[model samples]
Target: MKPKIELLAPGGDVQAIKAAIIAGADAVYCGLDTFNARNRAANISFDQLVGIIRLAHQYDCQIFLTLNIVILEQEFKTLFNLLNKLVNTTLDGVIVQDMGLLYVLHHYFPTLDIHASTQLTTHNAGQIPFLKKLGVSRVNLSRELNLREITALAKVGQEHDTLLEVFVHGSLCVAFSGLCYSTSASAGNSGNRGRCSQACREEYETTESGHNFPLNIKDNSAFFDLPALIEAGVYSFKVEGRIKGASYVHTVIDSFRKQIDGYVATGELTQDGERLYKVFNRDFTNAFLRGDLNQSMFIDNPRDNSNNHLVDKLKAEKGESISVVQIHSAQQQLQVDKQQITSSVDEKIAHLSIEKIKLSLSFASELDGPLRLTVVTEQSDSLLPGQAVKTDSQVFTSSSVMIPSEELSVDRQAIEKRFKSINNANYELVELDTQQLTDGLSIPFREITTLKNELLSYLNAGVAMIAHVQPPKLEHHPKADGPLGLSMLICDEADVALADMTDGDIYFKLPDAYKRGCTKYVDFLLQNPRLIPWFPPVLIGKDFEVALNILQQVKPKLIVTNNTGIAYHAEQLGIQWIAGPFLNTTNSYALLALKQGAACSGAFISNEINRQQIKQIARPKDFKLLYSIYHPILLMASRQCFFQQSVGCEKPRIDNGCMLSCDKSTSIKNLKGDSFAIDKQKAGYPSIYNQDQFLNTDIINDLSDKFDGFMIDLTNIGAGDRVSPDKVELITQFQALLDGQSEASAKLSRLVPESTLLQYQNGL
Candidate 1:
């Protein structure tokens, strides 16, 4: 038989975890109060996590902890402390996004399994070898991949002995995961840090038309593609929604469970797709999964919330008064018997409890010897978390007796019958081994019953001893040093010309949206021998191939990229690359890993990190680093076109062939009354920038010695709140600051009215 495909469900809290297991999920993924993607969810505390893990294992369901958020240098200690505590529990594995954390965990906890999170942006097969070398047992492919792309990557995974995981159902992000910075730039709450404000789900007005939600893509539902996914060798089908309530969790999991089982048994789905839609959805689209992007994936009626009747119908079908207990909240706990309404659904919840101990048994009865029975009880110790332990392997012997063959022959069948009669609701017989010595062996039936009772008592005692094992303390790591340097990222031809006039060995960054018309300037800039082309964060399919062809023809010495797909292409083309800011390089180890894995020449520190955390980064001698001082921080890069939506265009506007009918230099005002500049020139996708410009001239002097150089990104200066339209004046003003001119700060304030320090003083 083929290996069963795992149905992985989400557990937002303890109640959700229980609901998922009872609803028939093979595995559940959950998070604690910290270090996970869903920070807004009412996550379980560390104390509650231990109990949840034990409970999950008791139900024969695996629990994979979510440590999917990026980790700063200072947060390492807390992460280590949590992992140390988790060593005593039965956690199946961990899902990680940061390469540094993956490296540290794989090395320190060699026995634990590691899965690469979708935030890694693993869309291509070329990125698999590097992750496999980092000790990743499974890779969660990016949701942007189509069916053919996924199948290709799955084959690669099979060749490398690595597993592939895909998100079959979930809300889709307009920008690729880990590539978006909208929440961070707009609200100071980064998606990478698990505090996203969901800036995508907001309203904005276009220059030519009225207001609309152009960035809100519909939720993805791939129920129809289950057979193809399984056939392509996908090991796990992940359902995304850690912030949803228990009723939603139970409904979705149970529905999918039935579908998966039905597919496995009869090669057909037994559940209705409408039931899944009724559970909760913005709209449904399998665009990327089916390799069809031309379809309309956005809902015209975006905010109706029409699934309330479905929740009531499901509640009526269950026929039980189920009260979902909020054990962690003191106020909610006080009203345990009272029905509480949740945001996703309004259904009553009831609680039920059951416990069972899984064990293996062996029996030996010789002709002239004692009847020996051995019961091996499994235990989860800190040193052996998630691994089975035989706590009681020794044999218990009974008195031997001999009798005539005709008297009362205790045959193998008789002995087996007696053992099967031993019953207990809390005990599960996993395996049974028997030895027969039936010749001239006669024993009374009463003796067999007495032996079985004694064995149960012995097994119970061993279970208590194994449950009390404690975890061991872990050791700490010391900081180290590295090299640093400076680079400038520019958006247009004017900024490139200004960069040529600057002093020192500076590199010019070509915008990700550079078109064929811009090639004339490339030869002119190449005279300086320091131009690096930047690839967009969402490169895949034909776009990726086209970009690869262009890069090959240009044959630039170095490239800059954020997505793993581009990194793979760069490596294959024999070009050295640098990690972009969107890669979220927070700690020193991640820099080292990228340098080795992606052949990176240098890296830029993430804007989300604080000044103190930046200083704490241990620099390596060969690795170069760059820090940005001035730039219009990117709020979002969405596939949806605000201009097209505003103009009432019905067809999907994905490619550049679709005309941007709005004024090119226009800005959009959000609900918060803040205006963000929208640039639709980049492949028809809108790249939004914060209204306020980022200025950190005060700390340049202190960081000059530590970093190789500081950066001034004048990419979308005109779109910023206050800035002169003259390119030369802007570049000269930034140049004065880089040179440490005393009057530069005063000049900058006069040039730009409102600016933000942006995490330079405070961390996320």
Candidate 2:
């Protein structure tokens, strides 16, 4: 028989985790109080995690901790401290998002298996090899991928010896997972940091096509499609609800458990998916799984659809709209069913406790013989004296001898103090039974430490103690003071003339989608040597291949790429590459990681950070730091059509033609009366942008000495019907500002009057 696909569930807290384990989750992924993407989830503590790991192992269930946020420079010490403690535990794996964290984990904590987080925006086949190179054992592919794309990537994963995990059931985001910046642009809640404000779910003013929640899509469900997914060679089926309560976790996991087991055992599903509707959901859609992009993927509401779903089902059964009295009756029935599920889950998990295992350490010593220690783990019920030992006892002999001494005698107090580490996350030193040995015995202090280390090794399943790692001191390689250069981005043929206006570099923006075997980009780059290629953050399937082709053909001296897959390819081809701003480069270590790991020449500091955050970054030698001084504030880019609900597209669904040929624009205003531009450029994905462009002159005045280049965007992507700013005058003013001309700042502020710099004041 083929190996059964693993069922992965979310564990938001101790009770939820227990609920999942009891509900038959093959594995559970959870987050700690810090450094995880789901900050809103009731994440567990280190002690809880340690105990949870022990309890999970007893049932043959694996626990994977989520530390899947971009690490700040100051947070490394705490992260390292946590990693040090984690290495000693039998943790199954860690899910990661930051490139720098991957570098640290791969180099220092080699034993911890790394799973790439969905935040990596892993979509293309090239991304598999890229992450595989970074020591990722498993990858959670982008949630937006179709079944065909997922199957193809699963095959790539098999070739690379990396496992693929797909989100089988979850809340759906209209925007791509890692790329959404909707809240970060104004609310200071960066989704990259796990503090998403759910901008996509917020109510907006009714658009021209009449949508109040334009960005909200229906929840994703692949229950009936498990057989197909299993056949696609997927290794893990992930359910996404870290912030959801234990009741929801239990219900969803139990239902899926029945579905997977029945299908695997009998080649036929046994459970109906109706129980899934009893829990909190936005209804369910499997359009993405079936590779069908259409209007039905979205729902009118973003709240719990369970009550309404029941009413709707009842009405549909009668073939008409139900009365208020009938609706209330149906909704009340849903409430009762949900209550029963919650009660059942609570009762089943009442005996499952995550409290630290109690330990009784007995020390025996006589004359000069080596000291002996016996360890017994008491049951979770707090076993009384002389009660049965729930676990086997292990005896360890010390390498050092104990001598009779009156001054420094070995007592319970001394033993407890010396073996204090024994009362840690996994084990609680509840009792120190030193009655086996006579008093007035002493051993060398270092010998006490040695014995403790030995006992710890035994407690950790005979694994040697892994010493805490202090990151090696990076050389303070500050660059020589130099004036920052001006760089401009051009997306149109008309803006190419701006290159002759200044001696500064010009970058031609590349499209996320490309026509198959397209040589136009290669020819364009070849003809325009002055224009450097600027690769976007997202490129999947043949589009990635086309981007790589452009690189291989033109072989530019240097290029800037937001995609790490492209960065990896560039490094392999011996071509220098700059890390784009969209890569979310935040700290000094990230800069170091990019340069050392992929030979990155330079990187643009993330625009999401404030002045203090930017100033704190230490530049590596010979690495350039570029910042965009002016550009449209990008909210998000999505594979789904934003035009479907905003202004209403004529086409029923999106296709390659829509991506490569469609050019449309619309706007959606929120209840706060803030407008967001929905723009689709020719040969580009649908995107949401802040109505105002980002224009910051303060960074130039405050930290010009820290950067190698200051860039301005000349693209007219998010302008909509707004009047265009003069490209020629903008270039001249940016250059002058870079040259320290005080008047240039005021002139440029007038030229770009309709811009905002809110992100500069609010750092993540």
Candidate 3:
């Protein structure tokens, strides 16, 4: 039989865990108080984690801890200590976003399972084998995958024994997970570090039209696609909401649980669309799953449109049932009232009741011999509700003394009654076998109950024992050599003209959206061996193949990319590549892992890391490290054309047929009156850049020895100046600073009054 698809729910806190398990979740993924993706959520404390795990295990449910955030080098010790503490607990697995964290966890706790978080942006099958090599047991695929892509990955997973998990319901990110830097760049709050400002949800105006929230994509609900996902070999169906309330978690989990169960049993879905909507949603879309990019997926006006009548009906029904329970205890009544806004009385009742212990019994006897009774207990398989019987070897078994001869003539009905008398609703009799006891057999009611109690006690003790088993320790390696060099990222021809002014290696950033004007730079690039071509970070879907073809034709010295798909493609095309900042390389282990790739030359330290944190990175001594010293920080890169969406342009520039209206300077003003420049001249999508240039001349001296070179990113600079005076002046000052000129700082201050240091001094 096929393994039942798992329904994994989010447990934001202790209350959320109770709600999810009571709602019939097979597993609950939650974060602890620290180092988790949803740091904003009221995560459970260390004191509460053990109790929650025990409670979930009692219900035949699993608990997966979320350690999915990117970890910095300085925090490695804290993480190691946390892992040591967790190794002694009953944590079923850990969902991780950092490759370094994955390596450490896999090495330290080899027996513990590790799931690659969706933040890893694992969309293609080619990336699966590399993840599998990293000891990842499961891969939570990126939400951008289509059914065909999912199927291909599923096939790869099956061959490698790595499970494929997909998000079936959740709020969709406008930018691909892990690749987005908007919040970090604009607000200094990184999504990678669990502090997203949600700049995508803000309103913006286009040149031809007024204001609208163009980047706000709708929530994803694949309720009708459960069977299709299962057919595609999805090992787990995940629901994404870590910061949501308990009631929302319960309703969503319960609704999906019913749908999955109904489909598994009868080959048909049983959707509670209204209830799911009422739980919480901006809007709904299955566009990504269906490969329908043209579909209207954005929720221009995000509002709750749930049916009020349905909500009222559910509340009224719950009120009637809970009134009796409320009358018993004033404290319970208060709790019930508080929870009523989030959950139904049935859900509350389930939470109040402790999970039952599952047990099985068998009776055997020869025609002339004495009767024997056997009791077995083990972990429950909730999916197979009625078939909990286990073999002698599979469970802790205790045989009772043979039935007395005098009991042979006892009433058969009486024996059956004794077996059924186990009460408190705390014991689920999975199976009972009575083969040779057809004539008659009697057992005292107290004796039968005593045996059941003993088995429960044994199972409970076994659980504690299982939790204490520790994996063997592994060896740890210290810091090593890494690549050393200075590099520059040039975006425009003006920046290209000034590239030679600075004494540094240059890399031309290929426009995200291919532009006709970029062709003019080809002759210039061919003449300069120092200038390498850098690929865009947001390549996926059809654009991925197109970008690959373009890069193949360009045939530069080496390629720099942020997307893993591009890295994998570069390997196939026999092109050398360097890991970009979007890959989130925060530690030495991740750097080592990336270097193992055939195409990878080295990696850039994540821009999110502060000076002190970056200094702690233990990369190979010779590994090249490119630090961004000067650049207009990228706020966002969107596939939806802002001009077309907001300004009512009949054709977006992405279509290649529209007039290049974005060639002119365009800026979006935020609530704070900070204007972000928009460059739509790129190939696939346009990017938004922060108004201020990020300058770090003060820290260059300190970082120079640690890093091989600094990257001067000149993308989207000098937006308002007609003669590009700001760009020229900024470049001139930067060149002086690189040349160690004494007046560089004063010169830069005169040209630019205010600049952002952006995570250089303070880490997020």
Best by lDDT: 2
Taking the tens digit of each residue's C-alpha lDDT, what string does model 1 give over 529-567?
A: 566676656655555555656666677777777666667
The Cα RMSD of model 2 versus the native structure comes to 2.4
Stretches > 4 Å off in candidate 3: 1-3, 202-214, 293-296, 300-303, 307-486, 491-503, 511-530, 548-557, 569-576, 596-600, 651-665, 717-732, 750-754
Is candidate 1 or 3 superior in lDDT? 3
* Tens digits of lDDT, candidate 3, 663-764: 534666766677777655534355667777777787667766666677766565434332333666776777667667868977776665556776676666
Can you give the TM-score per candidate against the true fold?
Answer: 0.74, 0.96, 0.73
Report, for every candidate in turn, its global Cα lDDT versus the true structure: 0.68, 0.88, 0.69
Residue-level lDDT tens digits of model 2 in 1-105: 856689999999988998899889999999999998999999999998988988788678999999998877778888889999999999999999988898888
Residue pairs with backbone overlap in model 2: none
- Rank candidates, TM-score, best first: 2, 1, 3
Off by over 4 Å in 1: 1-3, 203-214, 291-296, 300-304, 307-486, 491-496, 505-528, 550-556, 568-576, 596-599, 650-653, 659-666, 717-724
- For TM-score, candidate 1 versus 2, the one ahead is 2
